[model samples]
Structure formats: C-alpha cells, structure tokens
Target: MASPAPTSAHTGRHLPHPVLVISVVVAYLVALHPGTLPRDAMTTTVVTTGVTALGAVIGMLLARWVSRRHGQPDGQTRRVVLGIGVLVAAGGAGLAVWWQNLIRAAVGAVPVGPDWWAGATLAPVAVVAATVVVPRVTAVIAAAAVALTAGLLTPASAGADEGQPLPRTVSESGTLLRGELSAPEFERPATRLVKTWRGADGLSARAVIVAVPTGSGWVDPAAVTGFVDRFGADVRILALPYADVPSWQAFISDDAAATESSIALVREVAEVLQGRPAGDRPLLVLYGQSLGAVGADAARTWLEDRHPGLLAETVLTAPPAETVAAESDSPRVVVANRTDPVIRWSLSSLWRPATTPDGTVLGGPRVPQVPWLPVISFLQTSVDLLAALDGPTGVGHRYGVEQAHWVTGLPR
Candidate 1:
C-alpha cells in the first residue's frame, strides 16, 4: 500500500473547537449567583446562558468524531461535520429545557424568559449564525448572555416596572411609598393605610369599610388601595394588621388558623365601630382578595347568623366560594382567572363547601341568600385592576377617591 499520505499539515493541528469555548462560557453563567439580576432578568439569563453553552460543547464533540471519514480532499468530511453539528445543537437545546424546569420547581415560578424548551431549540441556530459571522462565537454569546442577565438591573424601557413590586400605598395625587409592611402589621399590610391617610377629607364621616386581606402573609398594600379607590363609595377601608405568625408559609398553609384569626380581627373592628356615634347604621362593606376574600365571606356569614342587620354588602375578588356560606343578599362579585392554577388548588379543600348559584339566598339549613357572579379573565382581573394603571395612585396605602372597573359597576 502506498505510504499513507503523511497526515498533511492538518495532522493533529485541528482548530480549537467552537463547542468547547461555548460550553465553558455557559457553565460560568449558570454557576454564577442568581441574585445579581433582577427577578425577571435572572430567569432569562440563566436559561439562555445554560442552553447555549451546553449546545456548543455537544456540537464540538460530534464534529471531532465525524471528521475521520469525511476528512477527504473531496469534501465529504465537511458535510458530515455539518450534519453532526445540527444534531449536537438539538441535544443542547433539549438539555436547556430540562434544566430550566428543575430551577423553576426550586424557586417559585416567577416569569422567566420564553419557555426553556423554546429557548434551547433556537440555541443551535444562534450558534451557527455566530460561527459564520464572528471570529469568536463563544465569546460573543457569552457577552450577550452577560448583557441580558445584567440588563435587568436597568429599569424597563416602558417607564413602568412590572418586576419591581408596587408600593404598599399611594396618594390620589400619585406618590409611591415603596416598602414592606411594618413589623406589627406584616401579615396584613393594609392596616398601615388607616394610620397613613386618616386625615384625607371625609374619612371620619364615611362608613367604616373593612378590608380583610387573605393570608397572614403580605401582599402589596397598593393593591388594597386600588380596590378601595375603585369600589369604595363614601366608605373608609380599614385594613387588618398582620397577626404574629411563625412564618409566611405557616400562615398561608394553616387555613383554619388564618380564618379564625381573621374573624377575630373583623369582630374586634366591628365592635369598635358599634361603640361609635352612627355605628349601628354604618354601611359595612366587607371586601378582600383571594384568602381574604374567604375571610370576608365567613365574616358576613357570622354577622348573618349573629347580628343580622349589621353589614350592608360583601364584595370578594377571587374569593374561595366553597369556604363561604350563602347568607349574603349584599351584592357579591367574584373575579377569577382561567389561567390561574392557584384558584383551583385552593378552592377544592374539604373544609370549603360546594359552590352555590350566584343569586342563591341562605338562612339556617332552609334558605340561601345573595347573588354570586364569576367574572372570568385570563389575568387575575382583580389583581390586574389594582396593579394596572386604572388602579390607585400616590403612596402609603391611600385609596384614591377615584373609580375604576371593580367599583364602577357596583349598584351605587
């Protein structure tokens, strides 16, 4: 056999594989601390960097293996390498999806970027494009990854921040007071509003409006303000303070305790009102969201069972219909999201009763009371109403005296 043509200048002089560089960069990004980016940015960066790097590594290995036979002067080797490159890219993309899902379960599912699978699928194509145009594709992708991850630190271009939480309260004039609830009322941040805007004209004259927030944990007090501005009519929203609980997780998980505690708060507030000058005739509208919604329903049921003529109306947004009794003739409107998995999970507990018709009236075991309507939307309509522009303004839980969707349709 003719001496095998001395392995040409190409012998062992293989160009550094692009895949190796890409993989290293990806590992670096994934391994980096997540807190460096804002909540949304963190998800996007981690997913992209992880997927791209993995794809590159896989592509390089495949290319090396396929080069043996296709390395002919005629050029079959280039074709083989190209085919292998595609396969490697696909594999890398698949891995990215898997990794992202794992991360999601670990942290609560906040909005990351596009779904992991979709991102991974596109990784190979991006790599190919980078390879053709850029001398160091790996470095370029890495740089892009860093930029994307870091960019979240910059406020969004929309001039509004969806990721950053809203302030707990705002004035009708539009001032944002951003911060967590105080130590005492952490469970129910809405309580702070009572102290913050007590002097806003007509507050003392208006009927005492009780806002029973869901859970012992805190939600943005601003949401409460939005609700008050939208629906409160000549009424003051008195937010309950957070009760001392071991932890947020415990408060949310311990439904019975939450309900009992909330009921006590409502009763205490009611008693205080009862001692006032016009307390007996005061129009008490019990309102709440999610868990607080249930609390409002239960409190109404208690009043119907005990006081009879105490409350005027109860409006619950995303209320757990099952936990609530049907003794309300006070117009009740419920907002639900078709896409919120949370509603389904929470409302189905054995402690809660089956849902009755919206207009059903209840008394003892004989009759049911009140009207029930399910307002459906993709987004949590009630939450959106509060968080979105048509909501409240200013800061420190001050519910503007304006009207919005949730309040506009009420039977004023």
Candidate 2:
C-alpha cells in the first residue's frame, strides 16, 4: 500500500478555535456596553456584526494564500508566523483606538470608560491564540472579532431633531434673509439664511458672504452677529443649516452627502447672483467651520470650475485632514489652533504636507507639545479635544472675536 500520506496537521480543515471565539465575543460585549458606546443598540449590533464577518472572510483569504505558498510550517516557522500575526494584530488594535477617539471629537461626544482599551487588549490575544490553535486558518477570526468589537464600541451620531419651519423670504430689515432650498441629499428642506451689510457707502460694491453651519445645526448667531457688526452693511451673508442629518457624526460618516448638498447650494447661489446685472453683482466669500469647513473645502474644485474668479476668499477654521489641499489661485485661508487636537491628530497633514494657505492663523491658547508617539498623542489629544468642547464657544475650535478682523483682509 502506498505509504500513508505523511500525516500533516495542516492537511485537513479544523474546527474553529474555541479560545479565539470566546475571547472575541467577550471583548466585543465588554466594549459595546451601553455606557461605553451610546447609540441605537440595534443599528450598532448589525453594523458591528457585518464588519466582523467581512474581516473574517478577508483573514481567511490571507491565511489560505500563506498556506499555499509556504505549505505546512515546521515548529520554527509556526513560531515566526505567530509572532508576525501578533504584531499586525496589535497595530490594528492601536489604529482602531485612534480612529475611535477621532470620531468622538468630530461628533462632540463624551468619551467614557476604558472599555475600548479592554477590547483593544483582547484583539491581539485572540489573534495569537487563533494562529497557534489553527495554524492553517491563522488569525483571520481574530481580526474579524477585533473589528466587530471596535466598531460596536464606537458612538453613533445623534438623531435629527424636529426643527422650526424654514422662513419664506428675507427678514423685514432686508439685512437678514432666512428660507429653505431643495437639495438632493436632504429629505427635508435645507435651511438658508442671508444677512446683508450694505456699508454707509450705499452698497456700491456688495460683498456676498456664504457661511456653512457647524455640526450643531445653525451657524452660531453670535459668530454671525459679530461678522455683521464688523463688516457693516456692504456685506450680504448667506447661511445654510446642515440640520437634515443633525449630528457631526452623521456629517463625518456621510461626507459625500454634505459635499453634494453644499455644491448644489453654491450652484443655486451662483445662479441667483448671475441673474443680477454685472455692476450690481456682489463679491462672494465662502466660510465654514469644522464639518462645515469640510463641506466648503470639498466644494472648492466645483466652485472654481463653475464660477472662476467669483470668490473673493474661502475661510476654513479647524479644518479636518481631508480639506488640506492647497488652493493656490484662490485666497484660501486656514485658521487653526496650535493646541487643538483635531488639527494635530490628523494623519493626512503628516502624510501629505498640507499646503500652507495664503493666510494661516494659529488661534486659541497654546497646548504644550508632547512626545509624538502614536498612542500617547492619541490619548492626550482626545482629552484635550473633549475639554475644548466644554468652553462657551468651543475654546480651541472657535475663532472668537478675531473672525471679523480676518474677514477685513479678504480681497474686494
């Protein structure tokens, strides 16, 4: 009889590793405790489960490829594989933690408890266990488990609130205008506000200012009021409230939706301006903060394409990494606080050196520089960001009284 095929442990499929499965489930449950992750429980569960399953499938594919190339590993080879697997899993865990903190900052959510840490710790442990127990299958299950755990633990955006109805026409004074416009991304009417400041010179040259609201629905009235106070009546301010989706979390998650809506709004605004006689047309200025900044930045290319030379300037304050590209031709200004974690934690700025804009102002109180380790930076900045949120106008994030001063510098 043919020599019994060399009995190989790796030759046949094996049952899932129990240790890996249990660790994964327990870790996820712990991280997703209601206090740890505040959101719609059912939605969280479904999304987390789906992500985990996808990760597992990807891991399995990677393991199979490795097995096909290397065949059954010797003791030493198995040890090497396990070591690499652990390192990769650990890196993944760290990344997940960083991302969680980033999202919390974006959505203005409170970060509570060390449940995420506990979940992160178990991720690598599960991966190593899975690799050792089922060498051929490797750590795919572990990866999947970790993904699910982390995802479930993250906070969800706040649901939209029933807002006051949009107004039909300009305010009685004619300096203020509030109304609604139709945009594809929004199921409800998009809120629009316009405040015109025709200076003592008698609106000879009108300055049209378009401001995007922050994550908190309408643009801060104080900020807008301040702008009008400084600019006088020559300026016309157009504002949009991004309240359809309501939360910053939703804004960040569906950036495309925000971008599309903004572009449409800008297009409509441009059409209205185009209808005016050339001599009467107002000089345009675009402004946004945080998520609003993101929307404004995303619309830059389209804005320039459709209405070249129309914009006097674009101001983005505390902008995220995604909006870091240089707008060399236009007067694009970036106002950032040196100590703000949101500005500092962005990996995009690191990867691609953000193009220094025409004007870059460092606002807020300085935060002492700390050692630049990934884990340390994430933890420190997360706390700092949360504290900044507590201030009356978001201390670090807000431009304070300096907004009008900066607006004065923009071209005519």
Candidate 3:
C-alpha cells in the first residue's frame, strides 16, 4: 500500500525547513559579491549564483518527483518549497548585480570552488525534498555543498599592488615641493595633506619625527610642531588611515588575518620612505600611538630589514603586543601607559600569563614601558581622533604645517 506524505507538526502536510532555507539564502547574500572571484565580475556572479540556484531548484524538484513516486503530494510542502526557492533566486540575482563594482575593487579577482554557492544551498534543499523523495544520494550531495559554502565563500584580499608610489619625499624640503605626500598604503584622494612650509629653513635638522596618530584621525601639523618644540626634534606627520578594512577592534582581536594585512600596509609605507630622496645619513624616527603605534613598530621592523641604515629610531606609545616586535638590532623605543582604556582592554588580554604544571610560564608579554608613554599616548590619540572626526581637508595629518613637508628634523 502507498503511504501518504508526512505532515508538518503545525500545518499537517510536510513543511520544509524554512529556517535552514533562510539561513542558506542569507549566507549566500552576504558572500556573493560579484567581482570577488578571479573571473569577470558579471560573469562570475551570474555563473556562481545561477549554478547554485539551479542546483537548489533541481534538488527541490528531484525531492518532489521522488515524493510523488512514493505517492505523497502535500500542499504545505509545495508552498514552502516555492517560497524559499523564489527567495534564493531573487537574492542571488540582486547580490550578483548590486555589489558588482565594490566587490571587484575591494576583494579583487580570485579562484572559485566547485561548490562555492550551489553546494551550500543544495544540501538543505535536498534534505527538505528528502522528506518526499527519500533519496540517500541527494542528501549526501547537499551535505557536501554546505561544507563547500563554509570553505569557499569568505572574502579574502587578492595580493596585487605591493610597490611604492611615485614622487617619494625623503625630507621636509621634498614635502614642501609637493605640499604633502600620502603614506604608501593609506591612499585616499580626498584626505590628502598640503605642505605649506616649503623652502622654510631652520627646521629641526637633527631628527625627523614622523608622528602617526593611533586612531583614525587626521594628523595635525601644529600639534606635531608643538611636540617637536617640546622634544627639540623636527616633526613630520603622516595621518594614517583606519587600521584595516575591518574595524580596529577586529584587527586587535586577530580576526581574519587582520595583522597580516596590517603588516603589508606598513611594509608598503616603509617602501615609500625608502624610495624617498633622504641622504644616506638622514635620521628616520617613527612615533605612533595605539594602532599607529602598532603600525609604527611594523614600519620600523620592515625598514631595519629592507634598508638597514634608513630607520634611525622607532617610538611606540601604547601599542598592541602583536604590533611590538622583539628588541631588534635597530634602535626601537616603547612608551606605554598602565591605564589606557585600549591598553587595558586589548593589550592586557594579549599579555595575560599562561603557566605550565611545573610553574614554567613561557612567553611572557614584552611591551617594554617608556617614561613618556602616558603623556605621549594620550596627546597623540586625542589630537588624531579630533582630526579624524573633523577634517582639515587641505593639510595632511600634521596640525599647522603645510602637508608638503615630508621629512623634518631637529633644528640645525
């Protein structure tokens, strides 16, 4: 005797897993930026979404056919299948087109996995269909698709540009020529600085203090000058961009290879500095707070290895441990406060003690404290944050100086 179709507990006629279907649809929506993969944007999006949607539809139909073969046709099951299937189709189409340009610019091109999208949706759809078709093989295919979704759909940057930009500025004079220079990786056409102190002599000639603000703030030239005057060093400022594509918080938590991206960025900045026209003996000092501190340490390390004689010193104020490298042959300085909110929240967690059974605690934190960390970190963060929130538009990260001044040193 032929058996009737199983019914849902609520509607009494085989309802599909709406929650599972919705989850799959949403994941696909989030993951399906058009040009992220290596192929042409339109083509990749169309092919990826189309194939997955087709697989889902096929799985749905197959499930229905098998169920009918077993003489079980239920209204509730049909309605759920129809509704979720439409969602899959619409979402795929919309996402494939909406972010076509953004995905291309942000993520670039990449290889596609066989089950990237289609595979993800296939499994659950097959499961819902299985209530009717009862095909064991179809269920297996669906599971495989879900596994592929987890593996293939996450966004990763394609390694493309790694070289320095043209018009390198090695000295404050070089900066004066160009008004201001942009840092290597943090290029934004709108947020550039203009250097007005061109041809101004008697600037500090002993050391060039490159102050990188911690948070996402515009570097103030006047404030930089103040620091220079206080410390008796010529200051040059480069307003660093936000730490990463993901938030600074995300970068701190070690999520999604954020540190790796940060390293790449800092390396690019070093390359820019190296390409500048500074003489063989010019001093290059980097000062940073918070994220800028982290970036400074990274830039310092890269400079020491790539161009040994270039980076004279590095001064960090309240940097994350990951941003702090071990004491290198180069002159490196750390200035940290015990009470900075970010230090307590982020660096504290990073530096926590982990002891073995024998009381051997390996790899204790190594953020050495400098005397000026409390003041330096606070001042740097405050100035940078204010500038970031409010744009000086014409000038770079420095407070009063024109953005053109590249490298400034202690007064001659």
Strongest candidate by TM-score:
2
- Compose the digit string of candidate 3's lDDT tens values, residues 1-412: 9877555533534544433344435434433422111233333443344434444455456555666577554556656765876677577655544443333233332333444334334533444355335546755765676586556443211111122122333233322212123433343311232122212321324444555543333233343554555445544443334332322543445332323323444444455556557763235566655555556666666666777877766655444434456565666555432222233232333234211111111111122222323332333222222222121222111123221122233322
Error of 2 at 363 (Å): 1.4
lDDT of 2 by residue, 49-151 (tens): 4434334445555555666776544444444444554565456556555555544554455542365465345443444445445745654654665586666
Q: Higher-TM-score candidate among 1 and 3?
A: 1
Candidate 2: stretches off by over 4 Å: 1-176, 181-205, 244-247, 275-279, 347-358, 392-394, 408-412
Of the two candidates 2 and 3, the one with more favorable TM-score, higher being better, is 2
Q: Count clashing residue pairs in model 2.
A: 7
Candidate 3 local lDDT, residue 70: 70
Compose the digit string of candidate 1's lDDT tens values, residues 304-340.
6766656666665544435555445555554443222
Model 1 stretches with alpha carbons more than 4 Å out: 1-204, 216-223, 226-234, 243-252, 272-280, 320-329, 346-411
Please say which candidate is ahead in lDDT: 1 or 2: 2
lDDT of the structure predicted as candidate 3: 0.40
* Candidate closest to the true structure, highest lDDT: 2
What TM-score goes with each of the models?
A: 0.40, 0.52, 0.34
